[model samples]
Target: MDQAALRTLIGQLADDLGWLEQHARTQPLHVAQAAELHYAGALVRNVVGPFLEGHAALPLHVAVVGGAGAGKSTIANMLCGAVLAESNPQAGFTRHPVAYAPASGAVNWPSSLGFLGTMQRLSKPEPSSLDADVYQVRRVSEEAGQFGVLDKFLVWDCPDMTTWAATGYVPRLLEVTALADVIVFVASDERYNDEVPTQFLRLLLRSGKMVVVSLMKMREADAPAFVAHFQREVLDKMPARAVATLTVPHLTPAQVVDPCRNAPVYRVPIVNQIFVLGEPVQAARQRTVRSATSYLMSHQQHLLGVARDDLLALEGWRQRVREGQMEFDNRYRREFLTTERFRRFDEALVRLLELLELPGVGRFASLTMDVLRWPYTWTKKLFASAFARPEASSMPERQVLENGLAGWIDHLRKEAASQTGKHPLWEHVQHGFSAGLGNTIKDRFNESFRGFQLSLGDEVERTARKIYEDLEKNPLALNAIRGGKFTAEVTTILVSGGAILYSGGLALPFVAASLAMAPLSASVIQMLTEFFGSQYVDFHREQTRARQQALVAQHISTPMADWLTSWPTTGGSAYERLQSILGRFPHNLQQMEAAVQAAMM
Candidate 1:
């Protein structure tokens, strides 16, 4: 790739890398894969970030990363004008990453704009010491800055991964590796091809990180063959997708320690120039980034599918709950409202009203007459008999309703259980808890009904009882209590006829007296009877309505509410919400298949 095209590609890679970093932060898995993917993202960002910016600058970031006393610090020194990194024999001496930038301020260092993610900017200058795994930017001395045309190259002194502390610091190692366009994976001739470095190399290859491997302390004669063997044995084993590989020649201690004494500018031939003067090897870098991006996109659905599957499973649960709700509605309507017990309730109210007006015991004149009347008596009797109390046949008692509700709840629990399958939250709901659900729901329903129904029925029933008691106390003992005035014309006709038939002119008065008294008494009784019958009809109608309301309030609504309330608590969490959608799926597929067949027609 030409420079501008390379820059554009770098920008694209950096943008993609940023997306991956955010994804990693938000969607970290419980396993090692999350960390590894995050590390890969970091790797891509670091290498590509610099190229995206319009700097003619190409600062190859070469990291000398390995275990303690494995010549990492020495390699760092060799790359940075001799012994810049402390070559302490003590393990874990270098705790952090150090950057040696070219001292000459001729070409400015590129701002870390496109550096994968945000980089920590350090204010301190010149061979600055850093905490482990953190990188510090320091200017390279003027004498050691000869290799590059533009002067912004830096060598990083990374921590030794073999140390106990390195596990925590590996992220820092990865961060430096990601930013480094050229990573100098430093290992001694002895430490080369170990598992840690090998693993790191695999990671770099996956992230498309370029590698300039340095095998330190090797004899000159063995170096070339050793490089070839290492390439075949180690590099070839990696996915054939690595960007580039470079092997640094081994250096003597004398060549590593002093920069000015050696004829070679840094006296460390392989490391100093490879790290400071390395370029992108643009074609290879592009190829690597492309492959890595392709792999990431290929597996994109895998990550997103986790959330999708969870939603689908949850929806499945919802559908089952909805079906259960429908079942409950059907059962409640059929089994309770249309029940014999409810019909009996209507009959009972009628009977209680009938009890008020007995056959012989009308204390009130009006009631006495009414009870004696055939029409009034038969109407009340017909009402009581036709809608008579049930023969206790399937008539649910209070206990039965409770049990039914409880059983219904149990059924719901079973349905929920059956529907949940292996869901994580299913065990929270068990059948025994259905009792509590039934009770709570039923009680709430009862409480609501009690607010309106119970008091009204009690008052109406109380009034009816009082009226019955009063009528019984004051029976019609005198004819004056009844109203003969109601049938005065009939009385006159009867008296006149009796007088004409039974008495001559002399006995007419006597006949009239007997006829008038009997006829008037009968007329008074008949009037009273008519009045009582009408009152009884009105009272019976009222009682029937009251009883019907009481039954509904007491039995049906409360139980239904209770059952519905238990649904969510019993492992059917919001399950009903998705019922329609899920239920329609099989049908929807069928429709689609039918449509396809039709199209084929």
Candidate 2:
């Protein structure tokens, strides 16, 4: 594989993953999914960085690891063909990992860039205990033997898992385990088949780590059968997902002291043969890497699925908002409109016109004549305005209405927040709920009210103007304005004169009737003004509330509910969106895996 090609691929993958991470921050479907994607991406970068640099690289590492006193140091010293560590016969004697590199000193450690999700690089120093956080590199000081194949290898002495702080070290162990092409699982005869080690074996099998199991101090005759049982109960039971397995024969303390001479030594021993002289070792290592890669691929779908689940919840939240809006609508229509403020639509204004019963100019002309009663007009207008109390309807105030609705939506968000714990996706939802609902409600309310007000005000002004024009065109209807003598003459002519004489000569009765009709027409005009004015205002109020309810119901509620409901089935977001996040890791991993295989070749 071209080194440049692989690097390009990895870089592209990193960029894609970074974009997803950013999106997850904004539009997270689920908080748990977001966290999982983030961590997986980090894992990809850690696994891929080493191979992108080409193959004049660090030795393929194999760490001799297990619980304390599991004979890791003995195995480490034996692997190097020299007593490099002090075998104190004490439990947990060798504290830190002591690397055994090729004696040629020509090899270099793998570059620490982009490994283990940006861990701090540790210098090579023998610490008091194998601080699981760090690893040390030591060079093999002996001359090379016939097999130059061992030159490209390094061993790590790791902390024991049976300790109290082992939980913390497990992640550290996984870090190195991922880095290693192979693992040396050291189990003494006393400790073999124990629970902790068995569980560790299962974990290794799951991650596709190659295993070399050393069963120390078994009876020579029992070794074959022991290996068989170990394979059946331990290896065969391994979920049909076993990585690799190898068994080491028994070695007494004396034989361990001089393993080259006393222990069966065809390339060290049958146990050592698996690591040292096996024809299939490289193939087995590749199989393990491939299996691990395949497992990761199977889980990639889940990485995207988590984000999908979170997105689905948004729809449910929106439905709740819609139901609330409908509830408010019912309450407002029934409670607010039933008040006397809206009930006496035209009655009050019609009664006010009754005070002008003395009659007036023409029908609409009374408005002008009423204005003539200037001093008493203020009192009349005051009495007219007081008939129906506007205060009750206006008490809550428009500001209060708007603020209350907004506060209610915010309260809904608070309820959501209380239910969703420590989840980053909920944080995103909270932000969206606050900002989206607030601005949408405010803008909709203001726009609806403004348009309704302008429309109703124009209609009322038109009705008033039309009434004035009609009365201005007629004046015989002003007998009340003529008053006293003119009124009495008309009444006397109508009462005493013959119908025949009163008929053609400015018919007195016709004139009196028209004059009487003046106030009646004015009352009619007042009724029209009051009816339409109040009706127009009420219509607009209902429209405002209705539109607000619609906005909450349709724009916000439905879409949100849909997003939440579809979370599980479609894996949350659309395939393209989820893939955008998942694609990042695989793209990076594919490039690095190919590059590493090529470099080794």
Candidate 3:
């Protein structure tokens, strides 16, 4: 792969990992996953990128790592054959890694582009307690050509792994460790079996770095037994094929002299182990690359768990959206659809009868029917005027729809507010809804409702007109049928009025009056059936009702429901970002993994 393209891919992966780290929930497991993801990205940008660029691996990096007060600085000093690092007595003393380059100048330090990702190299030395995201480099001075023993090597003394302050500088440690071709795991007798450093050592071995264990501050007589136990407890579970273990007896102050001249004498076995491993720099670097690649391939699922955490949060949001939709649907059914009578349907029926009149004699037929039905129409009108009951007003469709939307938003807001601390998704939703989301939904619903209302009248008229157009094909039969409807209308009014009088006003008067008119209406509808030779009138009415119901859904219910369902995934929303991160990060990681495989091949 092209170096520039690789860098771009690695850079993007790092950015995505950074975003995940920042936005993932604050749970301990989630934080640990984020940290792991961040470390993986750093490895790509720093270790893998430089390797692919064909940068010289002559200056092999060896990082000394261990838990707090595990004698890591002393081990680093021993490796360099000099007092390159300050081995203080305080636990967790080193906050950042300090690199010591050999004075021989046989190999140049890595360029700023890919060495320690994101950590600026300090020009002047700062205190080990200066907790910051930076690293310091110091050149080891030659004493009688003594430092030349480990020429062409860069040794890093890393901060403690098991400390409260370690969290602040652990990323610095991971950075240098990822760059190392060899890892000198310095474990004291007290810290050897400790979980924190042991896990770190496992990770280093799993990543394919050559490791040399230095069991420090143990009695000379007990060294053999201690080393045996360390091997069985720690090394047995490691993935590395071979790991060199050296037992460092409790040394006097004089024995901790300059490692350049005294390393071969005092730490002869450890010094010889380093020389044997450091001789094959090219092979060692290749082994590191191969090990890192294998670790990544095998651990891809672990990396994807980070993405899954965000996806799980998104799924929770979707579940809430589904619940909110159910609420909206239920509210709409109860508050609006069930109570709506569609009074305009009556007007459509009357218009249908007028259209049934003979095409050329429409006006004459209408007038004739009017004269015949005048008595019944007049009597019914008088009774209706006298006994009409006022309807109890209820909320309009617009208000009902708006309220349903508001209620749904309120539900989500309350849920989010209640659970904000539990997950990042809820907190994000709470903030979004608080910032005009409800108003936005209402505005969208109003727009759709107005459009629905505007088209409703035309839809009803068209349906009614279709019924007449079908009937017009048999105008002669339809006209005669229409004439008989007058007689039916008169008979219906008389019989229905007598029945109402017999019933003694038991029903609401308006309802009784409507009931009285039903037979006439049924008679006219029967003529329509006769003319059309089918259930045309009933079907048309059913079709019109269905259309109106659909309009209610399309114009009002659907928009609001969709808005609620999709609110979390809207543009610029946290859920949207999480989805993007989940999708892009994994794809990029797989691509980088494949690239690593190709580079190793």
Q: Number of the top candidate by TM-score?
A: 3
Better of 2 and 3 by lDDT: 3
Task: Give the residue spans of candidate 1 off by over 4 A.
Answer: 1-29, 40-57, 106-119, 125-134, 147-152, 218-233, 241-251, 259-601
Candidate 2 TM-score versus the reference: 0.55
| lDDT tens per residue, model 2, 403-491 | 54564566567757875764444555566565574565556566655654444444333443434334345555433433432343334
TM-score of each: 0.47, 0.55, 0.75
Candidate 2 local lDDT, residue 351: 38
Candidate 2 whole-model C-alpha lDDT, 0 to 1 = 0.53
lDDT of 3 by residue, 1-21 (tens): 687888787677767666766
- Expressed as tens digits, the lDDT of each residue in 328-441 for candidate 1 is 444544554445333333444444345433344334643433433546456657998999875635534344445545555566577667755454335434443544755666
